[model samples]
Target: MKFPVKNELLKRLFAAQGEPVSGQDIADEFGLSRTAIWKYIKELEEEGYEIGSMRKKGYYLIKAPDLVNAANISTYLETERYGRHIHYFSTCPTTQTIAHEEAQGGAADGTLIISEEQTAGKGRLARPWTSNAGRGIWMSLIIRPRLAPQQAPQLTLVAAVAIVRAIEDVAEIQPVIKWPNDILLNGKKVTGILTELQADPDRVKAIILGIGLNANQESEDFPDELQSIATSLKIEKGEHIDRAKLVAKILHYLEHYTALYIEKGFAPIKLLWESYATITGKRITARMVNETVEGTALGISSEGMLELKLDDGTVRGIYSADIEIKN
Candidate 1:
């Protein structure tokens, strides 16, 4: 269900900052009847929004529940398009799957498919990704960039830079990117980005970028195997992090960096990505499907491949591989 009218009403109510808004004023602004406005307010109250009304005053937002619904996220969004058309779900198998279908059905650019929980979330190499209920930013975004098919992989690096910038904005922590699509804090995995492409033979169509971020989960929220390797923003920040604000910040940066890549080139994005990379100048081993290569990590290539300097001093550009830091 699309909430164009309710979303605008939410933004207007949030702008009042708990002040009362007259029902007549809202009805006039939206060109809706007073009865229609009352119905919308009732729907919002059913969605966990505690709205109060006065005899003379129209309505006031008393409290908003911490949920990633359309109304809640739209109130904090500052982007022009990235989150404008949101498809929010309470629980889904995966946002990536849904975004792919939406993109195939001609979904608009910057269409976002976000969910509160993912029952069958996937990581790189089809690994099972754990997405705790209401504890992470599990979402996929659909983007249509005018680039060739071969140049699509660089968007993953572009998204990495955006995620790091967003984390920095909300928390006093240093987050680093690990190779193709992992974000780490205190040497533990906190975020993962998976970029999938849909294109023709020559031109490109849409790119579905799946982002899984552990936002407000505690340490004990993970399974035994993941207890040592996984972390969340709440565990690191020592306080509950606001997921809605963080989501908006990520969309804001994602929109900006993607536009920068499309306008200028990968050179600018590569520099920003390297600043937050963890493998530069470190001895690491990259494990691919066919073979493994041990080398000192050079920076990314022009096309966003990991440049690895082997023992014989031969620089190898690894397109896709699992990187292990040796040092």
Candidate 2:
């Protein structure tokens, strides 16, 4: 997503990436006066780019900020394909909803749908996902994997691993994956992954992975019910994070690990998931829609199902459930 600038001057500025572009050069390139070019340079500075303007040597981008808009993200993003096309929204119903529509309309793979806030964000089982304005990462990534529909569930775990790795890379905090979806920090959920697929009975058309990560929220940002159950990277790290950089890192690792998953089987990802597993070898409750079962978690199966050792001296594979780790 390109910014709505009068001209493509911003893209050229970033393309330069520190080498000074003289006002005369910009004026000639954009067919504007030197004064008009200077006005545009000032606008870039006001938009959080620490550009240096000299008397005659013109402007040089000294430092770029970590704003979570399309312009800012494109400035710092280093991924090749994952974030090639980003659709940004200030406020939306949900990135997932729009992503589904886009995917149905034949949007490209690795197209990212991101928003500042989600008014009606959804979680597994129709739970409300809290997404306050400018506080968290409410984004959906579209992927077209050449796999069967059954392999679609593996993408959720793939996203979990990517998110955790990205959090560690950027926030310097190690997050734990709770079974299939939630990424936990200090026993509270800091991120959630919701994977929705557009597929036939045998093949997959596209996978929409909604990643909700709390990057810079304060304790007061969450509702009363979520205050105790949710945490943000800022709250845990005691400093505000660079949301754009974090998102860039996430997209980088996501593209890498997703490609790895497509090539290799789930063996490698399963190993990484176990290293961050908090429920393996613990007592837990699986709250399914029909029945709730209590068991000892014996780790996950080869195919990514939760393996539960029930009290009946039998092991059961859980497909989908709300897991609760009990003492």
Candidate 3:
């Protein structure tokens, strides 16, 4: 496979601090010709990077735009396992779709597929998730868990708890999980989790957990339809969020939770998930695929299914549904 010369050159240039780096220096470092280095520099400029060059003063990086390059993410992660294998795209239909394909083709566990913009992103229940270009974190992780197929649903809950914990750690905002799989901030949607599994009746082969978080979008960045219901970290916190730091925190929490779940089971993570969950012990209605069930939300079971105490003095288990907290 050919190396990404532009990415490598950018890395070296950034490492040079404010000093001007000669094209010959970059060429000798990468064992390439000066012409090749110049070509790569032109490509980087075309990608919106402002590189300043003088007749004999060498090249200076004036600005490094926040582009979601795989090498850059790997450099930020600086790890070998999780997020080490990253596939980045400028624009795609959906990161989840690409992740699913990669998982099917035997991608390593903890592989991440991220995109700067997703034109056809989807959320839970096949709802459209709007991700403005370069505005939010549109990514998916592929995990191969050694668990029973029946226990796979718990992964969604695990991801939610991890995300909530990460948000609290970095942004100081206490986000909540709305049942089945949705993260909310101040009663507005901030993050959406979708878990897709390739498994048989007994065991799971691979699981793809897709997460879409509105990070740095301004209020006007969202469409008129979503302004009232959807929110971003910037909108909620009145500041631009560091997407790379958030991604690191999330991956750290996810790695921790996955290890704990495999060792002690979902009981431990379930407790943490319930602790941050805001929907429990409230009057709500669950909109399932077949019908909507009105009930008092009790809590999630050990298997990660929502236990709803319905009317007429009965309780029911909801495997998957959309939950609305009643007034």
Candidate 4:
């Protein structure tokens, strides 16, 4: 069966909101026969959805499988626009690549590209990211915000604050933002945010924000190198989390804060980002593309740059760099 028909059928069932959708209605909507609807229902059942049918009422969703597709994710979505259009893949090279292509092709403002596993996932500086199968949240969001090319970088801070709030809402854990783009838990990395832009010199077009979250991996899931530094939500929370629910929460907050940043400014986002900031006030070493600076973290500037107070009493605002805590 075609995936669009199946996905649309699932969406109709979900939209029914527990009420049974008539088979004839579905058939007419899709211009298919009743038998075709029944076959699609069977396929959904085989895929782990427990659908129920009445005599004349047709079919209603009794249970949804633990999947990250649009059907399962829509149940938890609360936003008006974000995540309404999603591209789900069982396996893909990277959501970032797909998101970029979609953005260039004029995809919707909140179109999301999500995958169950990323074959060639990447992080900041094009580093390889581990995207374990059936675990973790590998997704990229395409947002077309009303901002200039220079102000676009502040969106990264906006997204970081949203992710922290989402973590608090879903996992009930206190995750902190390690300056720039890493979200840390208990001093270990749990999530990484990579923000890419598609814009002209004077106008802003779109921002492809790639977020990779370690959701349900055990201790052995990480490579030897990451074992000591990386951790997952299941490991930290001592249980598995519903990835779909978390994704929905993240989208909700993203939509809220993104609007907030665009309307009010970066002041509110900076305050929230600083509250969960881990590197602020700590001595750290920042390695940029050219020079390295060791300084005391001095919170983020109005432009979302990391303000580092140096030994010579100079406060240098770092625009881009990989930072390490220096105790």
Candidate 5:
């Protein structure tokens, strides 16, 4: 679903610089009534834009607001398809839920559901994700890649690489990917990626990639329980961060990696993922739903399974587990 081009009046105002664009000119160009143009200006004002009005010269654009809304993100978008359709909300229950619903309703391949706050945020295995309002990025991308259901798990790894690259580009922080989909900085969780799929055993339908990055929040912003294990970019960098720029960088890298995965297969992405992963070659224990398997991390298999060298000589591939480093 594309965010419609209803801001033509605002665009005209921007292109005119400080010069005024008359209501009659906009009305003639867009075939809209003067009353319609007034409505657009009112909407823009509500979004934090300042427009100066004169007696006869029409409307002049004064200042643009710094919002992470659709208009702001569109100004910095470089992707051809991904993130072209953004559903921006100041607060929502969850972006993942919105993305899934839109995907089922025939949304495009690169629809982005972004929310400033998520009251019911989700983590891995239904755990609660701490998504403070206006402090971090709580967004989900709806991707309809042409991969099989078996290859679905690899997308999480793909998202991890893109997120890390975005962080390095903006925050200048070196983040490590803890197998599957957790990003760590200074041994604390800084970002989280949750990949959920709606597909059968054969073909893929949609992959909802949920990413939560702690950007401008302080240590005290997080709850007491999360203060020790969670951190934000601002906390580490000791400065304020621009969330909109970071979001743009993330979408850029995400689109690049997703396209590479589609055309060149997972070989190239696997190499990039391994460079950022820290669990490999370390002694770790995989905590499963039923049993805990402890072994050395032997890296991932060709199909993206975590290969663990057990106490025995045999090596095993783990599908789902919580991996914790032992030594």
Candidate 6:
């Protein structure tokens, strides 16, 4: 259930290598029973972890599954921290919800929660985000940043830049951010981001950054409702994408930009985000929560808000909205 406790067991089992580790050793280390150890090992097997068992040899870890586990992620990450603690699930309602709960319960900054599939995933404005099982990356990052609430919106921009950079590095295709949170490839939606904040009126307590990317899904893999509007990395690149490489790159860039934002300000990240944005200087209609405004999308402000110059000779700042590019 809780991965932290299980992760410790995996670490010990893995350290034993091909040499068998006694059941008593594991029970003593984690205060779990022999039956509990057997249950956890079975659960690992279900997730594709390879374990060997003999009458006298107890249990031996033959191979670690090629999945998004804490050990695998830590090996890929060069940081002393950040993503070192990961909570993985085969299925969940949403990684965002889990991350929120963990953050509230004092989970460390940079804790990551990911799932193979999310049933009730949400996007901006409570939109249902489609996450086909074992098809894409459904993950959320828990961040505890010392920034004002006004500055918190900038994290969305930072995440967008990080994701675009990661896609370029791993997928070898330069995807562009469709201003705000959507990542597009070859004129189709490939990724969506939803940023949630837990804070007071003036300061941020924590921020949960949710990222959903269409990694290895085939065109036919998507539901009928999303077939035309959504596209996956496999569809765009004509091959399956490496989810692990992309995930590592995303975390690297996110850590970099987040540190930059804290040390300097949003100005640098805003400039970089604008450079990778595909929507600026285009005629667009922004569908806000209240109304729609048609204007030339100028650029994002230094504060990471959208700026639109309407036909009525007035400039409007859009805090949050969905944008539709005009032909």
lDDT of 3 by residue, 10-69 (tens): 766777775788888777887989888888888878877788886665787888777666
Show pairs that collide, candidate 5.
Answer: none
lDDT of 2: 0.86
lDDT of 4 by residue, 149-265 (tens): 999888888999999999999999999999899999988899999999999998889999999999999989999999999999999999889999999999999999999998899
Clashing pairs in 2: none
Error of 4 at 39 (Å): 4.9
lDDT of 3 at 5: 65
RMSD of each: 1.2, 3.2, 3.4, 3.1, 3.1, 4.7
Model 6 Cα shift for residue 223 (angstroms): 1.6
Query: Model 5 over residues 1-327: C-alpha lDDT tens digits?
Result: 343444556656767888998987877787779888888788889888999998788999899875667776665667888878899999999999999999999899899999889999998999999888889999999999999988889999889999999899988989999998899988889999999999978899999999999988888898999888999889888887778778888999999999999999999999999999998889998999999988999898888889999998689999889988887
- Higher lDDT: candidate 1 or 6? 1
**Alpha carbon RMSD to native, model 1:** 1.2
- The predicted structure with the larger TM-score, 1 or 6, is 1
* TM-score, model 1 to reference: 0.97
For candidate 6, which ten residues in a row score worst on lDDT? 72-81
* Candidate 2 residue lDDT tens string, 223-309: 888899999999999988889778888899889888898899899989998999899889999999899999999988888999999
Q: Count the backbone clashes (under 3 Å) in each candidate.
A: 0, 0, 0, 0, 0, 0
lDDT of all predictions, in order shown?
Answer: 0.92, 0.86, 0.83, 0.91, 0.87, 0.84
**How many Å off is the CA of 274 in candidate 4?**
0.5
User: Measured by C-alpha RMSD in angstroms, how accurate is candidate 4?
Assistant: 3.1
Candidates 2 and 4 compared by lDDT, better number? 4
Candidate 6 lDDT by residue in tens digits, 1-327: 236555666766766768887877777777888899888888878878898887865888898765665655544554444676788888999999999999999998888898888999888888999888878899999988999987888899999999998898888888888878999988889999998999999889999999999998888887789888899888888877767667877899999889998999988998899898887889999998789999998899888788999999898999888889995
Model 3 — TM-score against the truth?
0.84
TM-score, every prediction: 0.97, 0.89, 0.84, 0.89, 0.87, 0.82
